[model samples]
Target: MASGFCEDCSRLLDEFCVYLRKVCREFEQKIRDVFRELSQCTCFRIAPESSFLRRRRRRRTQELLSLHLLCDDETQLLNQESLHALSRLASSEDTDLQTTAAMFYLHVSHHLKSSLPDAFMEPVMALLLSTDLDVQKTISLSLVNLLAKNNVCKELVIEMGMLVPILELFQSGDAAAQCHSCACVTLLASSESKSEAIMVDGIMPLLALAKSYEPQVQQNATWALLHLTQSDWSTRILCEVGAIPVLVLLLQSSDSQVQFYSCTALCNIAAVREHHPKLLSMGGHFLLKSLLTLVSSSVQKNSTQACRCLQTLSRNVLIQEQLMELDCLVPLKALLKNSSPVRRESAITLLSALSAHPPNNDVLVSEGLLEEIGQLLHHQTSVIITHSCKIITDLCGSSMGQQAVMDSLCVSGLLGALLSPSVSDETSLHVTSCLYHLVTWDPLKSNLSVTITSEQVSRLVRLSGLIQNPQLSYNSAAIISTLAMTEEMAQLLRPHYITMLEYLLVFLKKKDVKLQQLGILTVFNLKKDGGFSSLLAGSELEAQLWKVHAQTEETRRLLQMITPLSPSPVDP
Candidate 1:
C-alpha cells in the first residue's frame, strides 16, 4: 500500500508541473493575439457605420485597459515570463503593440531600484529604428524615461549603437518625434562622457532643426546646442557650422522659451571672442537689438543674460558705435535703476564698455547716465558700487563727463566710497580717480572751495598716506593740489598738510613716471598759495623734490615751474 501511494503522488507532481507550464504558454499566446488584433485594427481608418465604429472603439479601449491592468500587477510585471512576452510585443510588426510594449517596459524599468538587464537594451533600441511615426515617438519618449538619471542605461544604449539612429530621427521625423529625439539627445549629453558622442553624431542635424518653424522644435534644438556649447571646442564648432545666424534668427520667435534658449546659445557663442566678427557680420545687429529689447523690458529670466550678451558684444568697437547709434543708453540708464542688482551690474558693465570709447562718453553724459550711476552708490552691494565707480572713472576721462559728474553732485557719494573702509582697493582707486577728474576740472576751479568740504579734504589727505596704493596716493595728492589753489581751501587742508606732503614725497621718490609727474603737479599747485608754499619749503618734501627732479624728463618738466622758497636741505 505504501509503494502504490508513492507512485500516485509522483505522477500527480509531474502532472501539476505540466499544467503550470501549459497555463503560462496559453497566457502569453493570448497576450500576443490581442496585441496582433490591436495592431491590425486602425481606429483612424475605421468604417463610418456608427455601430461598427462604436464596437471597434470599445474593443480597442478594452484591450488597452486589459494591458494596463496586467502592467499594474507589479509581482507579475517583473517576472521572467512577463518580461519575455513584453519584449516580443516591443518588437512586433504592429505599431500600436510596439508603442504599448515600449511604454510598459519603461514603466517597469523605472520602478526597479537596480538597472534593467543589459539584454533588454537591444529590443528597446531596435524599436527606436521603427519606420512608424507613432512607434518612434513612443520609443524615444520611453528611452528618455528609462535612461533618465541612470548612467548604466545610457551606456548600454550607446554601446548598442543607437545614438546615430536616434539623431537621424531629428532630420526626418515629425515635429513630435523631432522634439522627443532632441530631448533624448539632451539627456544623453548630460553625461559628460557621452557629450562628445552626441556631438559627433547629432550636432549638424541639431543645428538644422534649430531653424524649424515649429517653436517646439526650435526650442529643443537650441537647448541641445546650448549644452554642446558648454565646451570650448564645441562652441567653436557651433560657430563654424553657422549656428550664429540660425540662433540669431530664432531670437525673434514669438515663444519666449524659444527666445530664451536661442539667446542662451548665442550668448555662449558670443563669449568666444573669435566668433564675434562673424556674429556681427551675420546680422548681430538684430541680436543686439533683441538683447537690448529684452534688457529694456526687464524680462527677469533673459534680462541678465541679454545684458551679458550686450556686454560681450560691446567689446567690439564697431558694435559699441552701433549700440550707441541704436540709442541703447536710455534702456541702460533705466536698468541702472532696476531693482535687480544683477541687472544693475550688467547695465553698468555694458555702459562702461560703451564709455571706453571717447566718443561714447559724451553720449553717456548727454543721456543722464551719470545721475543714474550716482543713484547706485546708495546700494549696499559692493560690486554695484565698484562698477558704478568704474563707469564714472572711465567717463571722467572727458571734460563733458567730468562736468556731468560734477553737475550731478556725485562727488559726495564717491568721497563716501573712497573713505569707506569696506570698499575694495580697486573701487577706492576708481573713486579717487573720478574725484581727481572732478577737482581738476579747470572750468570748475571757481566752485572748488564750496563744492569740496573740509572733511572731504581730510579724507583726501589721509588717502594720500596709503603707501600700498600709489595710484590712490597720487590721485589724493592731485586733488589737494587743486583745492589748495584758493587760500581758504589751502588753510582748510593745513592741519593735514604735513602728512600730505610726506605721502607726496613718497610718490615723488617712486620709479614710476606717472607718479613722479603727479607729485610735481601737487607741489606746483600747493605753491600757488604762499602759506602752503612756505610750509613746503621748510618741510623735508623740498629735498625729496630736488632729489627726484633729475630722475626722468616728465618729472623734470613738471617740477621746473615750482620754485620752492627755501634752498637749504632738511636733515634726513
Candidate 2:
C-alpha cells in the first residue's frame, strides 16, 4: 500500500543517519561532498507549492525520509568537535550543508540548552536567515522546541534581535513557515522579559495572526495573548491596542481551545476597572452570553476561568443587571453544588456580590440559591462555609430576602455553623451577622428563639468569644443587644448572666458609638432581672456613669435607664 511506504522509509534512513554522524568523527575530506549532496533533501518542500493559502486546511508535513532521519534515536547531538565542523559547514557558501545541519538539529538543537553555548543563538539566527526556504522552515520549528520554557534562550534570541525576522516570517511566510514562526513567538511570549521586544515588535502582528485562516496559527496567536495579558498593565495595553474586539470575535471560533484562550484573555482585560466601560460598549451583552456558556465547560480550568471572568464583570453594577437578565444564577448554583474548591469559592463570592442588588435577591432565592446555600453552610471546608455565610448575610439585608431566607433551611445551617468548633474567626463573623439580621427582623421578633436557640445565644454571650475577635464581638454584641430588646429573648442569657455582665462591661467601655449603644441597651436589659442587678450595678461603668459623657442621644437615653439602680453589689 502507498501508506505503508512511509513506514519502510525508516529502513532507508539508517544508512543516511550513520553516514552523516560518522562524517563528524573521521574529518574525512574525500567523501564529504558525496554525503552533503546525498543529504540535499529533494523529497519534500515546506514552502507552499503555490501562492494559495486559504485552501490549506492542514499544516503540510515533511517527507518520510526527514522525519525518519531526524527522530530522537537517529540524530546524535554535536560535541565540540562536530559542533566546530558543523559550524564551518553551516557557514559555507553552499546552502545544502546549512539546510542539512539545520535539519539534523531538529533533534540536536535541544542540546544547546544543556549548559548553553556562549553564542548559542548565533547559529540559530544564521540558519534562520538562509536564502534556502528549507532552512528557515526547519530552524523555525526547531526554535519552537528550543525556546520552550527556556527563558535564557528566549532572552538570547530576543537580544540577538531574532523576533523581528521571526515576526516577519510569521506575517509573510507560507503555512508551514507561519506555523513555526507563530509557535516560536508563542513560546517567547511566556515571560515578562519580552515586553520591551513586544513594544518594538508590537502586538498588532499577533492580533492579525489571531484571525489567520489556519486554526493552528489562530489558536497559537490567541494563546500567546493569554500569556501576554497576564499583568493588569499588559491587559490595559492590550485593550488600548484594540484587542477587545478581536478577543470578542474569537469567542465565536469553532475551535474550543481558541474559545478558551480568548475567554481567559478577556478575563484579564475585563479585570481593569477602567476597561469595563469599553468592554460594555464594544459588545458586553454578547460577551456575557459567551462567558455564561463557558461557565458550564467540562474542563475544570475552563469553568474556573469563566467563573473568574464573570466574578470580575459582576463587580460592575450594570453587569449585575445584565447577569440577572441572563439567568446567570442557574449555572452558578450548579457550580456550588459540584465543582473545584476554587470554582466554588468564586461562585460564592460572585453570588454574594450579585445579592447586593435588591432585585437580584428574589431571583437568587427562587433559583434554588437558598437551598444550595443551605447545603454549602455545612460543607467540609470552612472557607466554603464562610463564603456561603456571606451570601446569607447579603441576602438577609432586605425584608423580602430576609423573609424568604428564614422560610428556607439556610437558617438552621447557619445555627449549626455557629456551634461547630471548627468554624474560623471569619466564618463566625459573617454567620453571626446573618443571625443578627434574622433576630432583629420585626416579623421574626415575636418568635426569635424559634429561629435562634438559647444555646446559640449563650455562645455569643460567652466572655472569651465576645472579646476574641473585633468583628465577631461587634456582630455578637449586635445580635445579643437586639435580643435584649425583649425580656423573653433576654432570659436566654439568664444562665450566662455573669458572662453577659463581663461582655457588657467590656463593650460599655469601648469607643465605637454603635457598640457603646448596644452595650448600654444590653446593660439596661440585664438590670431588669433583679437578682443580677447588684453585680452589674457595682460595674466599672456604673461607678464612672456621671464621668462617662454619652456620645449620642440614644446612648444617653439607654445610659439613664441603668443609672445608680442599687448601691449594693451581688455575689459572683
Candidate 3:
C-alpha cells in the first residue's frame, strides 16, 4: 500500500506546479463570482423588495458552501500532491504564479484552521521583496497570521536560512507592507539566532522604521526591536545604532502601543548591566517617566514590562537618583495595590531596588511608602511576602526610613509575619533583620510594646533561641537586647525570658565574641527586670555559665556591670 501511494504521489508531483496555478485561478474565479452574485442581489433588492429576504439567506448559504467546497478541494489537492510537493511549488521561479499560489494558500489557511503546509514560508518570505505594492501588501498581511498561529511554522522558518532578505521589507516604501513586514520581522526575530542575524544587520532599518510617519509601522518596528534587543551582542549593536534616542522620543508617541513597544525594547537593552553607561550617555534616562506610565497602565503586560524595566534601570546608582529626581517613588509604590500578581511582583522588585538606595529612602519615608509595603506582609503569595520583607529590611538602612518603617510596620506588619506559624526560614531572617535594625538605631526613642501582644513577643524570643537558623537566631538575639531598653519593652519579653535566655546562652557559648557580647547584653537587659530576672534568680547554673564564658574582657565587663545583682551587660 505504501509503495502504491508513493508511486501515485510521484505522478502527482510531476504536475503539482500546474495544479497549484490552476487552484489559484479557480480560487480567484470563485471570488469574482461572489462579487457578481452580490451585485445581482443588490440590483434585485433595489428593483423589487419582495425578493430581498427570500434570496439573502440562500445566497449566504451558497457562498459559504462555495468557500467550503474550495477548501475541500484544496485539502484533496494537498493529499494528492503530498507535503514534499509544497516545497517545489513554493520555490517556483515564476514569481507571479508563486504570488497567486501564496494568496490561494493564505486564503485557504484562514478558512480552514488546520492541515495547511508550512513549506510555503520561504515563498512568503521571498515575496517580501516584490516591488509590486499589491503583492507586498498581500504577503505582509498573510504572513502575520501564518506566523502568529503556527509554532511549527516558526521553527521551520528559523531553519530555512539567512534573515538578510527580510530586511528589504523594513525599507519597503508601501505603508501596509511596511507595517506588516515590521510585524513579520518582529515575529521572526523571536528565534535567537535569527534575532542576532536581524539585529546585526537590520538594526538600522528597524530603528529608522521605528520613526515612521505611519503609527502602525512604528509600532510594529518597535515591537520587532524589542524581540531583537535581548542578547548582549544585539543590545550592544542596537546601542551603536543610536536606538536610545529614538526609543526615548518614541516613549511619547501619541499611540499608546508604540510607546509600550518602545518601553519594552529599551528596557530589554537596558537590562544588560554592562550597557548602562551607553544608555545614560545617549540620554536613555529620559525614558523613565514614560516607563512609569506603563507601570500604571491598566494592561497587565504593559504594567509588568514597565515595572521590570524600571526595576533594572533603578539598579544603576545614577538612574536611581534620576528616578527620585522624577518624583517616581510614590507612583511606584501605588502598584502594591494592583490585583495582578505579575505586575505586583515586578513592582515589588522595583521597590526593593529603590528601598535599598539611601537617597530614595528620603522620598520613600516622606511619601509614606513604608505603610503601603507593610500591608502585604501576610499576603497569600510567599514570594511577595519575602520580597516585601526585603524591602522593609533595606529601608531600615537609614535612620529616618527605619523610624518610618517602625512607626508604620512594626505593629501592623513585620511582627505579624514573623509570628506566623508557616513563615519560611528565609523570610524569618529578613524580618528579624528589620527588627534588629529598628532597635539598634533608636531603641529608646520608639515604643515597640505599645500595641504588640505577648504572643508576638514570645515568638520573637523563641526565634532568637532557634538553633537551626543561626543568622535569624543571632539577629533575633541582638534584637532582644535593644527591645529590652524600656521597662515596658522588657515587660513584653518578660514572659518568654526562658526561651530568650536559652538563645542568648547559645550565643555566649559560641567562639564569636561579638555574639558573646550581644548575648551577655541581651541577658543583662532581660535579667535587670525583677519579674524576668526572678525566674532565674535562684538559678546558679546561669551565673556559673556566665563565669565560664567571662574569660574575654567584654564578657567580664558585662559580668561586672551586673555585679550587685547582675543588672547589665556590655552594649554596643
Candidate 4:
C-alpha cells in the first residue's frame, strides 16, 4: 500500500512540474485553467492524507504559485497572476495556505514596495486579526514591511483600522507576535500624525509590554515610548503613568540596545526639570553607571546620547555629588577628548555641573580637567569655548583649583580667550573671572604680571571701557588693579588713565563692597606716579572720587593720595 501511495505521489509531482512549465510560458489563461483543475484533482488531495502528503501538497502549491507570482529572472517583482493568487490565498480559511500566502506577500511586497495596491491592506488586516498565532505573526511582519515601504501604506494601514488590533495582539499573542506588534506600533508611532492615534489606542499596552520579562518586547516598547515622549504632553503623560521606574529598571537590562533606548527615553523625560527628582528616586544611580559605561565604550552615537542624558541628570546638585562619588569623571574626561563635537560639548556641560560644588572642583582638578578645558578653549565652535571657559572659572573658585589653573599655565589660555574678539559676553565674563582668581593666587600674581604683556594691559583697559557686562567690567577692573602693581604696567596704563578712572568711578559708586574695594585699589595703582597723582589732582574727574566710601584705611590712604591735600593753602 505504501508503494502504491508513493507511485501516486510521483505521478502528482510530475503533473505539477508540467503545469509549472506551461505557467512560465505566458499562457495566462491556460495556467489558470491548469491551477483550477489541479485544485480539484483527487490525486492532489487523496483520502487519509498523511503528514508527508500534506507537506508535498503545500510545497507543490507554493512552487506552482511562485511561477505566476515571480518573474523568471528576479524573485522580487510579482506578475499580476501571482498578486491575484496571493490576495485570494491571504484570506483563505486554510491555516497553512494563509500562512504561506502571508509569508510570500512579505517577501514580494518588499520589492513591489509602494506599487502594492491599497486593496492589498484588507486581506492582510483580516489575517492579522486571525486567532492562529502563526498567521498573526506572519501578517504582522508583512504589515510592518508594508508600513515601512512608504507613507501611503502606512496611512492605509491606519485607514484600514489595523493599529488597534495589532496593539491588541500585544496582550494575547506570544513573544514573537508581541515583538512584531510592538515593532509595527513603533513604526506607526514614528509618524508625527500617527503618534497621537497610537498613543490613544496603544500607549498603555506598550508601557505594559515595556515591563515584560522578554527583552525584545521591552526594547520595542521602550523604543516606541521613546518616540511618543518627543512631545511635551506625551512625555508628561508617560511620567504621570509611572513609566519612569520601569524605564529606569530597564537601564539595568543586559542588552545594550535595551539599555540604550531606556536611557534615551529617561533622558527625554528628564528634559523637564521637574522629573529629575522622580528619576533619582527610582534608582538613577544605576542609570548613571550605565551611561558612564556606554561612554567608556566605543559606540559614538550611544555614548553621545548617554552623555547628554548625564548632562541633564547632573543638573541636580545631589546627583552631581553622586556622579562624582561614582567616579564619573573618568568617562566624562574621556568624552571631553571625543571626536564628536556634540559629545565633547555634553561632556563639558556635565563637567561644568559637577564642578559647581567645591568638593567636585577638587575631583575635577585632580582628574586634569583644567587641561582638557584649556584645549577646548581653542575649539572653533564658540559654545565649546564658552562652556570650557565657564568650567575653568568654576574650577578656579576653589583654592586647589586655582593653584591647578596657575600651575597648568591655563592662565595664558584664559588671557588669550579674554582678548579674543569672537568670545561671547558670558565667555568673556568667565575668562575675566578666571583671570581675577589667577591674579589673586598671590604666588601666581607676579607671574601673571610678567607673563601678560603691556600690549595685553592696553587691551584690558580697552575691554574694561567698552564691554557692558558688570562682572566683566568689575573683574577687569580688579585684574588691572592687580597687574598695575608693577611700575611698567602703571606707565603702560597711564595713556588710558582717564578712561580707566571713568570706568573705576562707576564701580566705586556701587553698593557692592568688592567693587568699591577693586575701584579703590585700581585708583591706588594708577596714583603711584606723582605725575598721575598730579594729573588726578588737576582733572575735574576728582569730584567723582569724593564719593569713595574709604571702607578700609588703605582705601582711605589711597583716597588721601589721589585727592589734592584739600588745596590746603591755596597759596593766595
Candidate 5:
C-alpha cells in the first residue's frame, strides 16, 4: 500500500500533506515488501541497506517531482507550494526524512551540477554547503548519479569552479563522499580542456589525498594522476610533484589492488618515450623486479598485470639493457611456454625488443632464442604462429639474425601461411611483411622462384589491386613491385602486368585526380623494363593513348601515354 502510496504521491504531490499523516501507516507494509524484494537485488546484498533503501524509493519520487517543477513553465504557480513543502521537510530532525529533503532540494536546485544552467547556482551551493555529513553524503551521491549521464557532471564542475571543494572532500569527507567526489573530478578531468585546469587547480589537493592512509583516496588519486599525465607536459609536472616516489611507495602497499593501479599509472606515464629514463632513475627497476617476482607466486590476474608492467618498462631502451644485465630474459623466455597464449605473445614482444640494437641482439642470439621462436611456429595456435613469424621477421630484417632464420625453414612455412585463403588479414599482413624482409635479404635470390607460377602471379595481381583501399594498396603495390624486379621474376609477372595495365588505362580515364596520379605512378615503374612497350605496341593500345605523347621528354617517352599512330619505339 505504501509502495502504491509513493507512486501515487508523485502523481498527487500537491496532496503530500494529506498523505503525510498516513505515510507511516501505509509505508510500513510497503517497507516490508521493499526489504523482501531487496533481499534478492544485487545492490542490497553487495552493500546491503535496510533503512536506506526503504526510504530512498519514496524520497526519489518526491525529488523527481521537485525536479520536474524546476523545469516546469508553470513554476510560478507551483513555487509557493513547493517551497513551503521543502522548507518544512528540511527542518525535520529525522535523519532519513532530512536526507530525503536534501535530495529533493538539490534536485530542484539543479544549478549545483551545471555551471551552464546558472538558474539555481547560488541557492543550491548554499543548501549543499550547509548540510551535515550524512545529508551532504546523500546529496552528493544523488548529484553524482547524474554524472553517469556522460559529460554532464564534467561540464557542470568546470562551470561551478568546484574542483577545490571537491578535492577538499578527498581529504576530509566520508568514504562515500570521497569516492563520489573523486569520481566527479575524474569525470571533469576526462575532458581534454579541463584536465590542465584540474592539474593546475586540483593536483596539489589530489596529491595530498594520494598519500592519505585511506586506500580509496589513494586509488582515485592515482587514477587522477594517470589521467592528467596523458597530456604532453603532465609527466614533468607529476615527477616534479613527487608522483614517482609516491607511486613507487603505493606499489609496496599491502593492498594488491592499490599496487595494481599504481603500477598501471606508473607504466602509463613511463611509456611516454622521453619520460622513460626519469621513471627508471626513480626506482623503476626495483618496481619491475618486484613485479616480475610476483609472476612466480602471485595470483594469475596479478601476475598478468605485473608482467604487463614489466613489458611497459622493457620498452625503454636503457631499462631493457639493464633487464638483460640482470639476466631477466630467462624468466621472460620461460613465460613463452606458459599455457596462456597471451603470456607467450607478451614474452615474444618483449624478446623482440632485444633486437632493437646490436648489443641486445648479441645478448638474445647468445641464448639460441631463434630456435625456440621457430618452435612456436609449429605450435597449433595461429596467434602464437603469427607472433613467432613477427619475431622472425624482426630478427631477419636485421643483418645479424638472418642466417639462423634461413636455416630454420622459417621462410617456406611463413610463405605457405600467407598463401592460405583462410588466414586472417592480420596474419596475412604479418606474413607478407616477413616475406618482404626475407626476400629482400635473400642474397642468392634463393627465396625467389625461378618461374613464378601462374597461380602465384594471379594472387599477387589480385592482392595488388587491393591497393585501391589505400592502406593495403601502397603496401601491396610495393610487394608486387619488389617481386617484379627479379630477372626471371619479370617474365612470370608478365601476364599479371598486362592485366594491371588494362585496369590502369581504364582508371586513368576517371575524373578522380588522386586516383589518376596513383595509377600513373603504378605503371611508371613497370614501364622502365621496356616490356610494357611491346605490350602497348598494337593498334589496341593506340586508341586510348594520351594526345600529348611526343611532348614527353625522351627519358620519359616509354611511360608517356601514347598519341595514336605516333612512331612506336621500334628500336632502342
Candidate 6:
C-alpha cells in the first residue's frame, strides 16, 4: 500500500510547481480544484504505508505554496494569489484548510498592504468588519500595525470610518476582541496631537473595561489609557467622563502591574496644568493620600508614583496647602531619612516644592525639617547636595526658617560639608552658595557669632592649599570673602589669613593667567583690613606682590586682543 501511495504522490508532485506558478485564469481554477480534492481525505489515521504518501503530499503542497509566492512579480498579484488561497480554505468543506486559509490571508494581506496600491485597503478593512469575531479581531489587529506605519494609511483608515468598528470591537463581549481593540487604539495614539480624537470617539466607555475582571483585557485597556492620556485633552476627556474614579478603583487591584500603571496613568493625567484642578475636584487628594500610603508601605512602585504625584501637586497652591493640612510632610520627610538614595532625593524634591510656599516653610521649620535638609548637604551624591543647598537657600529666605536652620546644630556640619574634601566641585559650589545665602541673610548677621570654629576656618584655608586645583581655591576664596565681610567671622578667620595669603602667593607663582589675576583679587580683598600689608610685612611677601603685579599686568596685555573690541568712542 505504501509503495503504491508513494508512486501516486510522486506523480502528483510533478505538476505542483507548474500549477502554483500559473497566472492565467484557467490555471488558478485548476489549482483550486486540486486543493478541494486534497482537503477531503483525512490522511492522518491511515495505515503507516499510506501515511507515508500523505506526508509526501503535504510536503509537495508546501513547496507549491512557496513557489506561488516567489513567482508573483507585483504586490497586487501576490495579494490576488493570497485571496485565491483564502477562498479555497474558506469555502472548502475542510476545517484544517479553513484554519490554514484564514492564517494565510492574514500573512499575505499584511505584506500586500505595504507594497500594493491603496485600493487593496478596502479588502483588509472588510476583513476587520467580519462577523467572525476571531477573524475580525485577528485581521483588525494586523490592520492597525499596517496603518500605523505611515500617516498616509492612518489618514486613510480614519477617512474610511473604520475606527468605529474597532471601537465596537473594544466593547465586544469577546475578551480577545476587546484586547485587540485596546491594541488598535494604542497604535492610533502614536501621534500625540491626534490623541484628542480618540477621546472624543467615546473612549471613556472603555474605562470600565480597563477595570474589568479579566486581567489580560484590563492590562491592555490600562496601557491604552496610558497612551491616550499622554495628551492633555484626553485627560480632560477622561476626567469629564469620570474616568478618574475607574482609574482610582484600579489602584487597589490585587495585581501590582495593573495598580502600578493605573497610578502612573493617574499621575500623567493629573500632571496637566488644566486637569490638575479636575483631579482635585475628582478626589485628587484622595489619590495622593493613597500614593502617600504606598510610599510609607515601602512599595517601591507606589513610592515612585507618590513622588511624581507630589510634583504634579506642586502645580496647585490649594492642593499644596491641602497636602500640608493632611500632614503629607511626614512620609516625605521620612523618605529623606530612607536608606534608598532615590527616595531621599524624592523626599528632598517634595520638600523643596512644599517649601516654595511661605506658609509651608513655617510648617517645615516648625517640624524641624531644616535639620533633615542640612543632613543632605553632605550626601554622597553632589546632585542631592545641590538640591539640598537650594532648599537651604529657600528655607533661609524666611526669618523663621533661618532661625530654625541656624538653631538646628547642623550649621557647623554644613560649613564642614563645604570643607569636606571628597565632594565634587559642583557640590563645593552649592555648599558655598548655601553659606553665601546664610551669611547674606540680613537678620542672621546679628546672631552670626563665630559659630564656625577655627578648625572649620583651617579647613576652608586648606581648600585653597592645593595649587593645582583652582575650582577648590575659588570656592574657598568665595567662602572666605563672604566670611571676611562679617567683622566677627573676619576676626575668627584673621589668625588664618597669612596661611591663605601664602597659598594664594604660591598659586600666583604658576604661569596660569587666571591664577595670577585671582592672586591680585585676593590681595585686594585682604586689603579690606590691611591684612595684605600684614602678610607682606616681611619684605618677602612685599617682593612677591610686586612680582605678581607685573606678571599679572603682562598676562592682561597678552589677552587684550582676544577681548571684545571696545565700542567706538562716543562723539563727545
Candidate closest to the true structure, highest TM-score: 6
TM-score of each: 0.60, 0.63, 0.61, 0.57, 0.59, 0.66
Question: How much lDDT does candidate 4 score?
Answer: 0.72
The C-alpha RMSD in Å for every predicted model, in order, reads 14.1, 13.2, 14.8, 13.9, 12.9, 12.0
Clash totals for all candidate models: 0, 0, 2, 0, 1, 0
Residue 151 shift from truth in candidate 2, angstroms: 9.9
| Tens-digit per-residue lDDT, 1-572, candidate 3 | 35555767878876897899999999999999987787678555644346785695465455344434555665553443333333443455655544554565567546555644655455556665555656666766676776677523654554554244455666556666666666666676564454454355556777777888887667778877776676465566677778888887887788878777778887888778887776677454557767877677777777777888888887888888888888776666667777666766778888887878776776777788778777766563656777777777667667776677667754457778876777787878877776665665554225554656677777777777787887888887676676534676766776676666566666767777677777767667666778766776656437745565556657668867875764348752
Candidate 5 residue-wise lDDT, 263-294, digit = tens: 77777776776766566665546756766665
Q: Which is the better candidate, 2 or 3, if ranked by TM-score?
A: 2
Candidate 5, residue 571: Cα displacement in angstroms equals 26
Task: In angstroms, give how far residue 409 of model 6 lies from its true place.
Answer: 5.0
Candidate 2 per-residue lDDT, tens place, 536-557, comes to 6666757534344534556768
Kindly list the per-residue Cα lDDT of model 1 for residues 1-572, writing each as its tens digit: 35555777989988999999999999999999987777667864544468886896676566566568767776655556555656666666777767777777667656655666777676777688777777777777777776764724665565577777787777664777777776677666554454454455557788777878866666777777877666676676677767888788777777777778877877777777788888887554777787788786536777777888888877778888899888887788887778888878877777777777887887778778888777678673677776776677778777677778777757667766665668776777777776766665666544555677778788778878888877777777777666646667767877876777787778877788787788888778777767768788757889888677555557667777787645658842
Off by over 4 Å in 2: 1-124, 130-161, 164-219, 231-242, 252-256, 277-284, 339-343, 358-368, 380-390, 445-448, 463-468, 484-495, 510-516, 528-531, 534-572
Per-residue alpha-carbon lDDT of candidate 6 for residues 139-205, written as tens digits (9 for 90 to 100)? 7756655655551355556556666788778656777777677767666554344545654564755
RMSD of 1: 14.1
- TM-score-wise, the better of 2 and 6 is 6
Ranked by lDDT, top first? 1, 4, 2, 3, 6, 5
lDDT for every model? 0.73, 0.70, 0.67, 0.72, 0.61, 0.67
